[model samples]
Target chain A: MIQGISIYEILTVTTVLFFIGVYGFLTRKNLISMLISVELILNASVVNFVVINKYLYPDMLQGAVYAIFIIAVAAAETALAISIIINLYRQINSVEVKDTEVMKH
Target chain B: MDLSTFLLMRHEIVLLVVILLLIIGEVFIAESKKSSMVHLAVFLFGIHTLIGFLSIDYGSLFGGMFHTNALIQFLKNVLNIGVLILLLQSGDWLQEKIIRVNRGVEFFILLFSSLLGMYFMISAGDFLMFYLGLELSTLPVAALAAYDITKRISSESGIKLILSAALASGVSLFGISMLYATTGSIYFTEISYVITADNLTVLAFILFFTGLAFKISLVPFHFWTADVYEGAPISIASYLSVISKGAAVFILMILLFTVLKPLMHIWENMVYIIAIVTMFIGNLFALRQQNMKRFLAFSSIAQAGFILLGLITGDQLGTATVVYFLLIYIFSNLAAFGVVQAISLETGKEQMKDYEGLYRTNPNLSLIMMLALFSLAGIPPVAGFFGKFFLFTAAASKGYYLLVFLAVVNVTISLYYYLLVVRAMFLRKSDNAIPYFKSKVYMRLGLLITAIGILVIGIYSPIYDYIYELSRNLL
Candidate 1:
């Protein structure tokens, strides 16, 4: 599609990364690791935008701009998540998913 | 932006100024004197609500990335009213406990910031603006959920909230990217003109809907709701239930009705299944809730289900009913939570069992709680009944009789659990019941206003007609 690199190839890579991130998110017991998985998922979307912009809509820079905004938002989300994890750790002395079930019926 | 464009955002500008003044006051004022910040916030927000009603500007800004109309203004005003009530209800509790000393400023700051984000969200005309507003609204709430640093459940809820929100938003962003790739534009007007119901587009729509579903706490995505509601302070819990959820519903309704109108066939069917599941799961879980907050959380989830009935119709009547229902819901939910906050502040009890013989000790509060619950259960002569009636009628008009029937059955199921709380308060007797306590002026006033709203809004046809007129111009 573009200089020998196909849009479908990039999409396939992003889709795989997205699924891997979801799998890690579901399986990981540690909070920080799960946060990292979320970051992966967000980056997959970033990659998606870059690829789509570069290949499909090369006339406009809107998709690239959206990618930048997404990166900034992802950074902010990570900061908030880490702070919350630290707060939870201070209270329970653990960051494991198994230990956070304090409100179950 | 020109002066006229700036004038269109007067309510937001006013709020921004108030927040700045609050920050300035916090910096210059002494710790003891900083208590006045609550009064200042309440007064400013009250005035802002009044000004919002007078703001009749209808236009777009930032190359159609933001929109403002009578509908957005109306919703913003309603949110301001809800927030005002929240501030009033949380006054005594904050002054005495929870927000201890000078830390009250940060609580208000976080809340106002979150409200600001919701305002932007309600007006967002593009995907990027919507995503920005969504994150801005959400991240601060995680902090509010964990406001009580001393409580383990508080921080736990905060962690759960932020993690799930991150996952949901990320998934939604992926969907947005898909949509952008398909349509080559992020602006709602542009996308609406270009979108077609292709397979990839359908996938993108479903993913986007799922993300919003998490915000509205619909069914499978609702696992975090009760936990967060139970752990967060009563003020924050009510804010989550009413203000945050209300804003999300407003924006979601607009997006579905306008930008995604072409894909209504796909979404309507999806919403049909989600609504039935959400109502059933919410009511079933509510029956098992020992904690009052969790009970209300599930109850609100069920309410979200009923709201979806209107959403499925995708017509003027549906829009009117949803808007009207949210207004009634705000008053009804706040009244209930105000009572809980008062009782919890007076006595350190938060269980259903703790509410036994409540009527004998605090008849006024128990009565307010009963009225609020009656409205929520959609009993005759209360605001919730008319709200539910209109929603079902809207769906029925669309020939969705089965969905309407299921919703009625869900209403009946919901009434049982709502009555359970009433029964606990009125029928059961306990030796250690919370004694009669005099609520502060603000709490009483807040409850009284909501109680009046619960009673008056349903019986008055003018308000419903007015909302109907407003809903017609939503596009």
Candidate 2:
């Protein structure tokens, strides 16, 4: 364990961050904002992996490696999301979530 | 360290080669000859499917980061067959619509890339590989979902799918982190050995299951399914509904039955509830759908519910029944979607009303549609009946009698809606029915294959034995 920081403290922070992202995702109106919330959500897990690995099992590198892969995958996912959102914006005048309801039953 | 250890991944290696060859072929092949790419893809993939059936030694690789067994290989072959049928069904659309405008080869490339991802996702022995494979399979389909950029609604669907997928996967990753925190390892075999039913671990499982539920389009997470299916191309929609969902279901079952086995007491109850909720929601919503795509979307969700019935058993019977059901489902769902594709491609009409008096004009397509729907509704003399029967039997064997009774009720409800379409086609009449038209040979072949699969797979009996044998690997 780290000398100055407890694992519980770090985990508590991530729990808050994760739920904050969930709230943002639920309440956000703009597509880009929702995407940002997703990034926050992903980063929370990324931190959890790193912190948990550092505190609980300093001997193994699996958690750290997993965190790295998550970061890289998150970047790729964000790029893909932005491209799709851009296409949506081009077709419609707005990126607001309300405008995407052309497919209602 | 010898060469043969690597050959266990023959499916991935061969699929990668086919994808690379297709990329090169697209670059050199002239634009006017673009149709050849479709034929090339289908041919190469057909060869891949044939080779996949030839067994390889089952074992682990890369310090057990990757693993393959009889069960995984069988699932991959099932997927290969599904994609082949999809490609055949999609060939005409690519040649006529997509090839004329842009490099048509991309459709194949993206599809193969997604399939490659599913391969890794299912075969993955560790969390890193699993997460990577999951993302790989999903990202391409989002692009495919938005293929028709000209249609504003299509792009809209694309955005919706990507956003939901990202969020769902992120939630799942958090679950993985929790699992790691609880077990201090990401490898499934290792984690299974040390795992215990702690509160934190249960939370992790629930969060992780949200991701699978999203992919499977279980209710509450299924808001995007109907919209996405409505907006995407018919072939792409069918691909999403069957192939990827099948892969997701396989991985969910494998993980639940293996790595999460110690937590069975916890998740069985969870699966019990999810099974009931997904069925009622999927069936109830399916009854009201006017558009064929949305109708099938809801139907597929209900099928996913039924798959969970076998899942709750957590035994060999559950495993065998689910795999067998998936094979039958692929044919039945594809046949239904194939008819939709052929009709939409030719006439650009997708409403239930368009099918009225359809039998008078297009008797053959109507017959295929009726057979497909009957199989879906689990009537006798078709593969879907056998599939549903086995699933109920699997569940009943474990004494989930209430769940089984509810599923039977859902089946009856599902029959009403499925028959609604048949009613429209045969009994109802209309002035402007879809006129007689011959599907391109590839489309015909696709439909013919599905028809034969729906008719013969259940009665054949040996295929079930093979899948049952494979299921023993897990249980």
Candidate 3:
């Protein structure tokens, strides 16, 4: 909630958040953790959208509306993905990507 | 922007109707007729798509956020045909599962819904509509990616796809925000005027390009592609690789030629660098893939790199090249997947080693696989060869000689791996090879359609002329 911060600061924070998500995605072994990383990345993007919408083009709410749709879609995607992961874990008895190469040539 | 204008194009109206029917089918269709429901949906879509092609009168809708020029309409028709073939090829695979879990109509519903999204995405005239359409196209396919809940790999693929899509969408939105901040407009037409050779605009363009690169699975963003394609079901993998990527290519062509025209110098340079990297990385990875799907996944990435050559030109000829290349790509890629689907069903094996001596057991499939692989490698007398030729020519026309030269080198590298599949089928012999693997009538018919499409389009010049004229008018 820093007031009168420069546009560069907002962009920097957004980039930092995105990098953190990338790191988590790269390092995380658990599938759920990777999914969370994705959520983090998505949020970072929404934050950038909001800040830009407020500061740059207040007239066009398209960015803001798009941000909301991303949230909704991301949530739906997470629900479906998690359910599939749980189902797969039940069948294969493991969630490690290494064990799931059943269809490889 | 008028509501009536929104319904002006026959394809748009048909697309909307199909989407609604799919949603309704999911909610109201009885379990007993679910298989029939899938067929009904496919038939309905086929007819509507044909009508859309036959009734092509160019018009714009919603001010300029939706377009229905002949080129895009033809592209959409090709996509529709591709999806229909996919559905047919998947019928047997889908039938077994639908009966098991009462999934029934839901599968077709989700599929058509995804197609609806892609339709809007290809036709989108503005950033807002484009973004919306992309999400709509993507989210359902993410679900479809993990349709086989019994397999851990299916779930993993689903999760990976969702995470990747989320990141891509988010980053893309941020870029859009930055664009709006700089230009004070979200409409693509207006943004074209606002983008100058400015640092901020260039930054925004880079950010935007990254998001799209993720979708196309270019280098540095392609890690998920092999895994996801390998993990997902064959039908889903084929859909993701051909249909989703095709839609993105259409959008990319439009954006580069129209909206991002002002920043052509900046982005074209970036595209050239990316194209080379993507081709090399894709070919190198593809060579190492023991899994058939992963092999094709990497090959598709390499193909995307080739498509970028057309986009890099940023002209009417480039647009024609991309559109024509995509049409050819649909046939070649889908044929490969169709053969793979046939074999996978027969033997439940997807490894190259499993395909050892496949030629003796299933000569037809082996031949199809050989043709598909050769076409992908740009061997002459195949659709894929012409596709690459057009893409390379378009780039060379832009004085991108180095890029074209590197691309030719990459094509040679790709030929090696594609030949690997041919070698496995012909030279190596499997002890426990599948004997007389038979596909369903629909699948066989579908494969034949795609095969003929590959051959006819390659040998014919009139098709290219038609596509070129359509591109000129549309662009």
Chain A TM per prediction: 0.94, 0.96, 0.86
For residue B242, model 2's alpha carbon misses the true position, in angstroms, by 0.4
List iRMS for all predictions. 0.8, 0.7, 2.8
| Model 2 error, position B73 (Å) | 0.9
How would the candidate models be sorted by DockQ, starting from the highest?
2, 1, 3
What is the TM-score (0 to 1) of candidate 1?
Answer: 0.98
Candidate with maximal lDDT: 2
Off by over 4 Å in 3: A1-19, A27-30, A88-105, B1-4, B22-33, B473-475
Candidate 1 lDDT score relative to the true structure? 0.91
Per-residue lDDT of model 2, residues B1-475, tens digit only = 5987899899999999999999999889888788788889999999999999896989989999899989999999999999999999989999899988875888888999999999999999998998999999999999999999899978988899999999999999999999999999999999999999999999999999888889888877998999999999999999999999999999999999999999999999988998899999999999899999999999999999999999999989999999999999999999999999999999999998889999999999999999999999999999999999999999999899999999999999999999999999999989888989999999999999999999999899999998898898762
Residue pairs that clash (backbone atoms under 3 angstroms), model 1: none
Model 1 lDDT per residue over B1-475, tens place:
3677777767778888888888897788776666677787788778777877773668887788888988788889899999999999999888888445457888888998999999999999899999999998998999999889878999988988999999999999999999998999998999999999999999998888777889999997998999999999899999999999999999999999999999998998999999999999999889889899999999999999999999999988989999999999999999999999999988979899999999999999999999999999999889989999999999999999999999999998999999999999999999998888999999999999999999999999999999998888675
The model with the greater TM-score, 1 or 3, is 1
Better of 2 and 3 by TM-score: 2
Best by DockQ: 2
Candidate 1 chain B superposition, TM-score: 0.98
| CA error at residue B165 for candidate 3, angstroms | 1.3
Rate residue A9 of model 3 by lDDT.
Answer: 95
Q: Which candidate order results from sorting by TM-score in descending order?
A: 2, 1, 3
